[model samples]
Target: MSRSLQTLRRLALPAALAAALLAGLQAARATEAPVSLAAVALGEADYQRVNDALVQHHVVPRYQVMAAAMAALDAAAGRYCAAPGAGTLAALRAADEAAVDAWMGVQHLHFGPVELFMRSYRLYFWPQGRGRIAQATGELLAAADPASLEEQHFRNASTAIQGLPALEVLLYGEGAEETPSAFRCALLTRIACNMKAMAADIVEEWQGGKIDFARTVAEPGPDNPYFESAEEATLAFFQSLYNGLELISDARLKPVAGASIEKAKPALAESRAPGRSLRNVVVNLEALQGLYEGEGGPGLGDLAVRSGADPKLEPLLRKAFRLTVETAKGIEPPLAEAVVDPKRRKAVDKLLTQLVAIKQILRSRFSPATGLPIGFNAMDGD
Candidate 1:
C-alpha cells in the first residue's frame, strides 16, 4: 500500500485499539523524515506546474514591468526634450531611475526571449569601461540628429550608447544638474525610445509573440527544441538563481571591490557615476526571492523539497537567501566610493562573504536536491 494510504489506515483504526500499539506506531513513524505526500511521485504534473508557475508568475511579469517602465522613460525623455527645465529634467531623471530599477529586477534572466537579438545587452550593456558610455553618448550628440539613434539606424550602433548606461552618462555627471542642449536631449530621447522598443520586444516574445520562448520553456517534450523534459526546464530555472548570484559575486562585485583592502579598485565599480550600483544588486536579490518562493503559487523550493525529502532543504534555502538579501540591504550606496572607504568597505566585503556562504548551500544541497550540478552555469563556455 502507498505510505500515505498506510498512514491513513493506521489513523482510521477504532479508538478502542490498544494504547501500546498506538504508541509503538507513533514512535516508529517519528524516526522517518517527513515527506510531502503530493511530492512523493515526483512526476510530470509537478514539474509542469512549477514550470508554468515560474514563467507566468515570476519571469513574464518582471519583463512586463521593465517594458512599462521603459515606455514611461521614453515619454519622459520626449517631454523633457520638448521643453528643457528643472521640472522636466527632474521628471526625466525619475523615469530613468524607474526604468533602471525595473530592469534590474529582470536583468538576471538572460535566456529565453531576452537572449533573442541580444536584447538584454541592448537594454543595459554593462562594464562599458567607465568613460565609454560618455564617449558613445557624446558621439550620438555630436551627430546632432535623432536619426542616428532611431531604431533602424541605431540597431547596429555601438552597444554602449544603445541602452541605460548611455542614459546615465547623459543624465548623472557634472553637467547633469542642468538641462542639456536641445541636440543632446534629442539623442537622449532617441536612445530612450530605442530601449523602450527593446523592452517591449522582450515582453511580447515571452508572452507569445513570434519567438514564444515562454511556450518552449513551459511545454518541454522530446520534440521540443529548448527542453526535452521538465527536469531540464527545472535546471534552467535553477541556473538563473545560480548564475545571478555568481554574476553579482564575480562579475559585479569582486572586479570592483577587489580581493583585499590594498587591492580595491573603486573606479571599476559599475553604475558608479549614477550612484545606484548597490541598489541594482539589492533589487536583483528581491527578484531572486520571488523566484524561490514563487510569486503566487508553488516555486522551486517546493520542487526541491519534493525531490529528495531533504528535511533541511527548504529552511536552509530560506535562511541563505534571506541573509544574503539582508546583507546586501545593509550596505550603503555610491558603491564606487564605498568600496574604497576604509570604514564603509567592510559592509561591501561582508556582502561578498554572505554571497559565498549562500552559493555553497546552493552547490552542496539545493542544486543536488533539484538534480542540477554545482558550477553548471554556461559562463565557462561549456
Candidate 2:
C-alpha cells in the first residue's frame, strides 16, 4: 500500500465514538445543579489590568515562541532538502515536534489576527476530513514539479496539503526517511517556509502596533469592532478557556477512548503519526493552567480572589490542574499505543475522568467565583 494510504488506514476509526460519548456526557450533566454568577461588578481598571497581564505574559510570549519554533523548522527543512541524510531527517523531525509544541501553546487563542486570512487552517489542517491529507499528499508527490513548488505556488495550494499534517506524512510516514525524492524535499521546504512566514506575521500583528490588539481589547468601546465592553472582552477570553478544554476532551480524547473500554480505538488520537498526541494534551493543560493562575501576573484566578470569592478556590483549581497534567504524563508515551494496552487503557480512562473534573470546576466553581457566566456555546457539541 502507498505510504499515505497506510497512514490514513492507521489513523481512521469510527466517527460515532465522539458522538456517543458527548451524548452520554451531556445527558448525565443535564441533571447537575445549575451554576449562576453573582452580580459582582468589575470596573474598567480591573479589565485593563487583566488585559495587560494577558497580553504581556500570555498572548505575546506564546506567539513569539511559535514564530521562533516555526523559523527553526523552516531552516531545518531547508538544510535537510539541501543534504538528504538520516541525520538531517532526524533534525527535521525534531524541529517539526518543537513547532507543534509551540503551536499548542497558543492554539486556543481563536480570535484576533490568528483568525484572519484562514491563517490558522493554513498552519495546521487537522482531522484531515477523512483521508484528504493522504490523498492530497499523494497527488502532490506524484505530480509535483520542483520548479513550481515555490512560495507563491503554496499560497494557492489546497489547504489540506499546506499545513503540519502534510508535513508529518512526508517526514515520518513509511520509508520517507529512507528515500527522499528531490520533489518531496522541495515541497517540504516550501511548506515549512510558508508556515514560518505565517507565524511571524501573527506575532507582528499582535505586537508591532499594526493592530493595537491590547488597546482594542482593554479599552473596548462602540468604536472597537471586536469588543464593546470590558465584560464582553472578559467573556471572550473565558470562552477561549472553555473551548480549549472542550477541544481536548471531545475532539482529542473522546474518539480514541470511546464510550467504553471494550470499544477504545487508540489509532484515532491526534498527532498520533508522530507519537506526540499525549504531549499535546499536556502542553494544552499547561497553557490553560497558566491562563487561570496568571503565571506570575494578573489572571482570572486573581480576579476571582479580589472579588471577595473564596481564596481557596484558586488553590483547589490549581491542584486539579496539577493532577490532570501528572496523570497524563503517567499514561505511556505515544497515546495510540497506550490506549490499547490493558494497564495503559485504565490510565487513559483515568485521564479522561480527571479532565471531566477540571471542566466541572471551571464551570461550577471558576465561572461563579469570577462572576463570569459559563459560555454554553463553548460546551455544546453537535
Provide the TM-score for each candidate, comma-separated. 0.85, 0.86
What lDDT tens digits, residue by residue, belong to model 1 across residues 1-382? Answer: 7543343333223232234334543453364325433334567777788888999999888889988999999999999888888899889989999999998899778788778777788888876565877887776677777567566888878888788988888888656777678777767888898888888888888888777888888778989988998878877888888778888888778988987768888877777766788988899888888888889987788877777545656765776577678778887778887788888888787777667656655665566456565564544776
Candidate 1 local Cα displacement, residue 57, angstroms = 1.0
What overall lDDT goes with each candidate model?
Answer: 0.77, 0.77
Best by TM-score: 2
Count of steric clashes across candidates, in order:
0, 0
Q: By summed lDDT, which 10 consecutive residues of candidate 2 come out lowest?
A: 4-13
Can you give the lDDT of residue 162 in candidate 2? 85
lDDT of 2 by residue, 1-382 (tens): 7532332232222243234434533553454324212324556667668877887898989999999999999999989888889899899999999999998898888887889888888888777577788788888889866656877878777888888888988987755867678788888988899999899988888875668677778679999999888767877777778788888888888898887767878778887778889999989988987887786688767776665444445665666677677778888887777777778877777777767666766775567666678866744665
TM-score of predicted model 2? 0.86
Q: Report how far residue 344 has shifted in candidate 2, in Å.
A: 1.7
Error of 1 at 183 (Å): 2.5
Instruction: Give the TM-score comparing model 1 with the true structure, all chains together.
Output: 0.85
